[model samples]
Target: MEWLDERKMDRGKKPGKLLGNKNSKNHMDLQDIIRESALPFLPAKSLRRFTGVCREWKLQISTPFFAHNQSYSFRDVSGFFCQSPSGALSFVSLNQMAYGVPDPSLKFLPEPVDIRCSSNGLLCCQGRTGYRAYYICNPVTQKWKKLPETTANHGTDPAVVLVFEPSLLNFVAEYKLVVSFASDLDGYEFEIYSSIDGSWRISAEISFGKMKLLPRTGVHVNGVVYWSSSMGRIFSFDLSCERSTIINNIGSSSLGAVNGKLHTACLLGSKLSVSELSNAYTNTMQMNSSAKQWQVKHAVTLNFSVPDLYPRSYDKETVLFLGGDVVVIRHEKKLISYNMKTKEFTEVITEEDTYSRMVPYVNSLVEI
Candidate 1:
């Protein structure tokens, strides 16, 4: 393990005298207190390196309380995990100096798995073979847990989403895996697997009549899981009440969440429009369904032509909402990020494979 050099630390700010004494015990205690308070703001990689500083620091850093505080303090988009159609996986770093993993392809898992969803730092993956088991893992720590099988069949390609929100009071990592699959009798059924109880239970609610949820478009906001549908609707499943609600008239667009608020990005002829869903959860419950829920947040016309960027019948293009100000769009073989605030276009990368899925990742210390 790499350790921070003492000489480098000594070269920085020198401590002033406390209680009129430079080397007094009170002065050392004040310094230690300041260091402990500032530790939670650092990255997980830096915290791991600082563990080698002393036994007291290691003990404090290894505690669950510290992990919880650090997770909330450093909640920035570290990078993304890109998975191709052939189950090939890769990592794209938003900032290489601050965030990364030991293995981007996730070779630490027991077998080959396809990543379904990502929340905070945990990844929900389904095994390619055998029972198609579900596994929740932390890529940074390389720790994973294989969940028990669900009562409902997830079909061949169901919409799977992982919901995990770190609590300030609760230190243990609790999460849920929601699967929206075709029902045996009707439209669609929801089966949720909870990590707290280590059990799976099929929800009593199902989708509205004949609605087919688009696979791989599930986004969790607040306590509800939202997915765009092929029938021009947005299907949302509330985890708190275990109920399903449908929001109509939302056209073809990609779903993303920023700071617990839901947003959508849609690409039209040479113009990219981004809209925010106001009163999303509350308005869905009201009987007056005629009120407009979507508010146009940002819309900018592209300087270059993107005539071929439209979705075809066979293959659909994707728009990714990265952080608060940037939206990434996959155009043919290239991935471009457009800043809503600055109105600048930056080419993230060029990929040979056109059918790649990108899931945003945040580097966290929450143990699995």
Candidate 2:
């Protein structure tokens, strides 16, 4: 009778154990399905809230794999980060007035700094606390880290560009920062900082012959930093190879990256001409020692008359940014964008005050 009772209890426990295992497996499957389906569609700002749902969600969102996958949805020009003369920060979305999406309320930066460049959702701000103070931050996350002082001495303000690419590597995520400037001796110099190696080093080709980097005109595309020069040249420094090469010959031009290609904006006999730099450095297998010029795919002339404020004809208006066919410029007291296709100019007003400097901004969840 005792043996019969033991067998009965064992039989009852086996069915319960099997049922529990099946339910646990189904729950894990559901979790994986949810993680895979929702992660791609969610905007970067939503990632923080979803991370708190569970420990699994927290681990998945924090992984570099998730960051890389989510980056694909970030290329759209969501908004513009505007900083006025008074050092007040405001973000204006392109679809703000139309779509009614609430403006992102990011934490204020500790100090006022000119947002110099942005790459892969990280912005590089040039602080006013002397020339050495620079901050790299994700504006959406409002997390910032100050950069190390540059090793090379720059007489003028350096053209700083940050290059960040999210990857699956958890340890020592690599970030490349290039600072191109005219050296004290009146020649071009490139000082680079690497997050993986954790130090700043000047480029191997230190003294670029007779070419000085133009102040406040630097743009990065596809892991290379390009700056217009004083000697009618557009030179590029490849962050991976740490080599410098001249790509175009645009004399004292303002440069911007549009559609992943370099565009030069220069005064073409009183009208601002937009020229796309195409087919510049394709042949890397067999090198051509001759100085290669960037082929202008097409050019568009803008109705940019000389503002009455500036008296000289040679006084070129600064091109703030170039987005697709639209060119944003500061003329007199107005911030306007000239459409290349339509040849129409529209005023871009943020609040009542005119924005001094404008750079293309895209919000993201990049951790500091």
Stretches of candidate 2 off by over 4 Å are 1-68, 97-112, 168-173, 209-212, 250-254, 258-260, 265-274, 279-318, 323-347, 352-355
Of candidate 2, the 10-residue stretch with the lowest lDDT total is: 308-317
lDDT of 2 at 117: 68
Candidate 1 lDDT, 1-368, residue by residue in tens: 12456655655534443435755777788868856788877667678878898888899989878888887666666667878778788887655666678888999999998877788778888888888999999887899999887787787777999988877777778888889888877778888888888999888886657767777788898888988777777888888898888875346677887656788887776778888888555454668666568888888887655665433321365566544677887766666778777887766564446544677787888777
TM-score of 1: 0.81
| Prediction RMSDs, each to the true structure | 8.9, 9.1
Model 2 per-residue lDDT tens digits across residues 263-340: 876554446766776667555635765634464544555565654332211124356666566666665655666767
Off by over 4 Å in 1: 1-39, 42-64, 279-291, 308-315, 338-346, 350-352
User: Backbone collision count in every prediction?
Assistant: 0, 0
